[model samples]
Target: MAGFPAPQTPRGFGSGKTGMRTRTTRFGRTVVALMLREMASRYGRSPGGYVWAVMEPLGMILLLSIGFSLVMRSPALGNSFLLFYATGFLPFNLYQRLANTVGTSLPFSRNLLTYPAVSWFDAISARFVLNTMTQLLVSYVLMVGILVVIDSPVVLSFGPILFAFACAALLGLGVGLVNAVLFGLVPVWQPIYRILNRPLFLASGIILIYESMPPLAQDILWWNPLLHITGRAHEGFFAMYTPQYVVNAYPIGWGLVLTALGLLLLRRHHARILQNS
Candidate 1:
């Protein structure tokens, strides 16, 4: 006891209330910092920071419209195919981008785990949030551009659009999370993703309506949740379109199931999987 001195408090540990506040602030800062780091690494070096986010979907729309318009004899989708395609493409692209990117996030961020805040979920969530926001912004820009160029009487409806986006994000989140974990576990999952994502373009209601199909085919495609989401999204844009466009409880249920399973799997095996990698 002759020469001992009191220990000083660490930077972030203080009185209980102050410590809690400090932790909360640190957590928020970490998330935002990670998000910005990701956004910059992914898109900042390009000439425009976020314009490519809008351009990507817009370019796809233009190429698809032009190619389809040339091949098809008549515009079967009426005078508003631009609006129609925009509605479908936006959500579908969002789902695809999120799923594809998230699948690689775990493996990609393995090194970043040296930092305490950079958990697997944090990495996945950052990518998901960025892609989802970009999709929404791109969707709005595409809608305005369509209205201007095509002169289609674009109807604005928030309810179904919101629902459509929510479902799409949930669906994408579930699929992406599961896929991310799987890819981390099994190398073969990569090739499988490549093959599986290809069919969604045709299988989803992006290019064709289920109603346009024969009764038997329509019945079959109704099993796909992407179709239901896209169909419901279109209904929001076109008043003539109805909720009955397609029906599939599978996507909604499957989405929840997959997301829960993903969380469980990640919680149990994330550290081991990454450590082994």
Candidate 2:
């Protein structure tokens, strides 16, 4: 009420319209401010901050390539193990980074949420945009670096890669939305959620090829939407690799459902959550 404008409406049952519009406008402004603050504090504080994103995956790809090259002769998809793992890990890393940060955005920005202008939605949205853009930029750098280094014909298809990255991010956002509220309200769910999701990276198609897995394994992992997105990313990166088991609808469907449900729940319980926080 303090930061928000006092909306003057007729003494009638149509107050909902004005109230909703007021909150929406305020939320938009609050999210923008939060984003800028995060950008400055999170990235601008240090000279090497932004480069960490690129450095993280670059180190992983190099280590994997060097270590695995000795044991395994060739990669499952491409000749360059660096390219193969980069395609798989970059998207998964994006999802992981986004989900973890977005899920905890409220608590991390709890001080800001105390202000009337900043709401839970604004905090989460700010983190989502900042992290997503950073991850996308990091992915582009790593992908381009790999292509340039590889001594082979590069066939780039933007559509599928974009779709796969989009799905991965969507699913991350949806899951983060649900987890954010859960952890923010309960606190105990934080440890439990981490324990449950400890094996997520391993299962996200980074270490193993999806199509090469056994039938039962595929059936079990089919429920994981990330598996589909990760596989599709590889398909996009390597021109010749066609993974038959990757279903586009799987991740999209789950992402939509999770996101919608999380938003509905959050909208209904936002005030209670703020009070608890």
Candidate 3:
């Protein structure tokens, strides 16, 4: 046994190869394995499975639309409160869920990191791909169902809608990268971070449009990339609300900076994380 290869950690997963092709193959398989594991543990094992995804957000949207419609007699945006809230709520929810999923991915999969086949990159990448894909699908199906059922009088722009979803993914992934390291290193920061960010939904432009907000609030929230994403989504769906506030490059830039910094930290501290955990 000692003279043998000492039991490799599974070749397809990771073999510590130096060539680009080998490294790519290794990482690709690792990601797939992680994704499959994630799917099984999350959606596959649950009873409601994927339906739960669409239902939770759908319920909130209906309650808000109906409850507020009774009070204000109409939504702040379009005639259909469902469309207005869905347009904003879905994207914000996507960003929020992606951030939370990515943020805690390290701690959630810490045990997997002990294997030579699994890298820190693999862990985060798998979570990002899985969650982003899941959220995008949920948003699309839910939005289409609402639009078809209600048949609202709105001209949907495909380009802006796609762009908004992409931005939400990037912004969430960026924040998640940073939070992954923070939560892993500190452990105690999770709840504090949650508490601090608890008001994010209120500030993420879910309940109101950007144009309807106070000028000072607008200036302050202008820096929040999520606001830009939600604003862009509404711009895509609502024909009347063509928001001029979104600076196309801001979210991308912030996302890049944060993701780069977070990757750098993980590249440095990943080994220590596994050791400690």
Clashing residue pairs in candidate 3 (N, C-alpha, C atoms within 3 angstroms): none
lDDT (tens digit, per residue) of candidate 1 on 1-277: 7599887887655577787888787767666776787788878867586887778788888887888878785443556556667888888887888787776767666778778867777777777777788777777788877879887566767777877777888888888888877887887887988897898898888888878778897878888888888877887877766767655465678779978988899888888768656
What digit string (tens of lDDT, one per residue) describes model 3 on residues 1-277?
6777666677745534546677899999999999999898888877588899789889999998888888887777778888888988887887788889988777677888878889889999999999989888888898889989887566989888888888888888888888888877888888988998878788878887778899999989888887888888888987778779988898888888888988998889877765655
**TM per model?**
0.86, 0.87, 0.89
Candidates' C-alpha lDDT: 0.78, 0.84, 0.84
lDDT of model number 1: 0.78
Instruction: Write the candidate numbers in order of decreasing TM-score.
Output: 3, 2, 1
Tens-place lDDT per residue, model 2, 33-66, is 8888987887787768778757878998899888
Which candidate wins on TM-score? 3
Of candidates 2 and 1, the better by TM-score: 2
Deviation from native of the Cα of residue 78 in model 1, angstroms: 3.4
Q: Which stretches of candidate 2 lie over 4 Å from their true place?
A: 1-28, 275-277
